[model samples]
Target: MNALLVITALLAATPITLEETRTQGRKNTQALQAELDVTVAREDQRSARSNLLPQVQLSAGPNLSYQGRRRQVVTIPVTETEVLTREVVSSANTSDSYGASLGLSQVIYNRGLWKQLEQAGVNVDAVRNQSIEEADTSELEAIRRFFTLFLSQATLDVLQATAKRSEEQLERARALFHAGRVGKTEEISAEVNLGNDRINVVQRQSQLVADQVQLAVWLARPGTEALQAVDPGILQQEPAPAPALDDALKQAREHRALLRALQQRVRVAELQRAIVRGDYLPRVGLQAQYAHGNQDLGPFFSEPGFGNTFNGGVTLTWDLFNGFNTDAQSARAQANIRRAELTFAQTARELEAEVRRAHQALDGQIASAKLATTNRAAATQGLMLAEERFRAGAGSTLEVRDAQLKLTQAELVLLQSRIDVEIARYALYRATGTLNPGDSQ
Candidate 1:
């Protein structure tokens, strides 16, 4: 830290080298790419679990009880017949009971090509694709922020250089005033101008720092090293040819993750309809229950203890008659299928439009970036001339200052144009779903 401070003092407004900042941004983007991959893998696992066999549960419990019974007796009448027989009968008793059991069941059949399972698989793909898209978007944002800070830092560097030149000119003006060749006002004006330039440099440096911090946060960096910025226009690639609108649209339709997810959802919707419609079909499955229990006896019934029970059978169920509800359900299923088909068609059209618009925008932006670069070159030359003319006393300080401002503005414009190109590139990547961490490297 002390070394950096010493260097800053010595350099006093000179542009610092920026090699570390770009590396940090790249690292952060790579991490996000890996994170997205994990997300996709988890979604795949979740889908597999959903497709697995249904789980069975077992339960057991005990019971207790008591009961009462009645008795009946018969006798002969006194006056009627000489001799008659009498009889007596007793009722049954009741008691407590306990039991334990196991049971099993499973899905036997369905129509529509195992639609439920297919739907689950599609959902997994959709979520994974969306994750990739989100990651790409995040990476793009990080790249932009890093570049923004870099450019801001560059601007500060230029301002610092210009401020130093003004300080030198201020010294010269003071010397000229002492020699009675220039007025005191010119000397004071130089000092005042230098102070303003210093302030400008400081403000821009603050902006650059804030931008770097934001970039670091997005990258999930672990520690703080005062991140330096990168030089702009260092072996920048030649602008690539823009694809035709139709071609771009076709590529996007085949690629964009959001579009693909929507396509998957349409399949899922169709599958859901098939699942409900399949309810009308007869289903076959095996079921088995094994139990052990004791029951109490009551009145006419006798008590039994520790009895073993076993049952196994195949079952078939058909909703043959359901107040015509199944017919309505089938119709609804058909309607949902139609709706999904329409949605798919609509999505395709929308995707085409988005791709076409992005292509058009990128073409225009690339041209704009080139023009801005040309302007910056010319302005730089103009500033050089102004500085030389002022040194020889052929031009006023105002001329030098004006040229300096022009050069800075030109630099800013070029920077903005470059940013526009990158943003357009991000747009293209979003449309095509072709953004890879590889692209950053």
Candidate 2:
């Protein structure tokens, strides 16, 4: 009893809502890596922008030297008499020198680099949009897995209930056969039906276990934990009417992250082409530097003997020719721009088709769900009447068996229809680029 209580408590604690599952899935490595890509893109933008800013550099170092000296005698003439004079010269000297220099450089004109900066900005936008699209895709995957598990569990439950009813019917058949009210063949048929139901139950149970394992992996949960879906009715609420195809297409154009990212790519390609064109123009910049040097570190700044110099100049560089490298690059850039434009156009058409398909599918599922609900109600009434008639000895076992089968089939169809509607609704949301965890209801 104590062990059973512990198991029950564990199971109770393990059940998670759809929202919680979505939250856990977003913490997965795939989603986190997408977010990291966004950060990397932002840093790249900053790096590109830094190239256009004034660059200042400073350098300082110390040097030590050793010297040797030699002495020489020279002859000098004074008042018609020759005199001897001593002269000294140093071949080497020991000295400590310290020097510091500061330099600044600014781009005055470099259209290529400027365009590159613009392209980097566009790249950042593109990556950011891509990240959002990745997030939506991940969340949709999680939702799909959740629904699959839910449907499996529901099927298992239905099978278990059907098995229970089959057992009861088998008991009735046995009693009737013993009393000679029913033939042996009828009893045998009930026995076979009960066996089939048991087999189905076992199979469904296995499927439920497999689905639970899959969902556990997605949620990053331990395999030992039991996973139970919340009531299907929570998700079976009627969905709102789908928008018209034209409206859906318009919404997709406005909201689709993939399209936004591709548009940014077009901008990036355009800027790249501009940058290549700039290669034909001369590059110009301003360069300035200040330097001070002396034999001693401390006296370098205070002493007048130190060499101090400041220089400033404007520089222009023209690459007259470089083995036609610029020409080839320009051609490539132009081609890329054309490719990007074509790709964007193709993707837009594909997105429109996707939205239209999702809209129609959702509509069909909703209608099917309504029809299934009505059929299940009728089947339930038929089962009740057949059971009553069998008890009154006015109907045969086969009639009851057929009614039960119809009812089971109807119930399963109804369940499936509801699940399909929910799945289709989410699909439509995904097609419109509006799917998110919060919108799952």
lDDT of 2 by residue, 1-441 (tens): 322443353366467667877677766667778889989988888888888899999998997877677665666665577675767564766778888899999999999899988888889889878877777777667777778878877776677677778778888888888888878887788888888887886677667677778888776778766787766464457556667788878778888888999999999999998998897999999999999898776788688555888999999999998899989998998999999999999999999999989999989988888888899889999989988887766777789889988988988898888888877877888888777524321
Candidate 2 local lDDT, residue 182: 76
Candidate 2 — what's its lDDT?
Answer: 0.80
The parts of candidate 1 lying over 4 Å away from their true place are 1-55, 66-98, 220-247, 294-306, 330-343, 437-441
By summed lDDT, which 10 consecutive residues of candidate 2 come out lowest? 1-10
lDDT of each: 0.67, 0.80
lDDT of 2 at 384: 92
| Per-model C-alpha RMSD | 6.8, 4.8
What is candidate 1's lDDT per residue for 96-207, written digit by digit as tens?
A: 6666678876556645336666766777776666565666666666766767766776666667777877778788777777877667877787787888888887777678
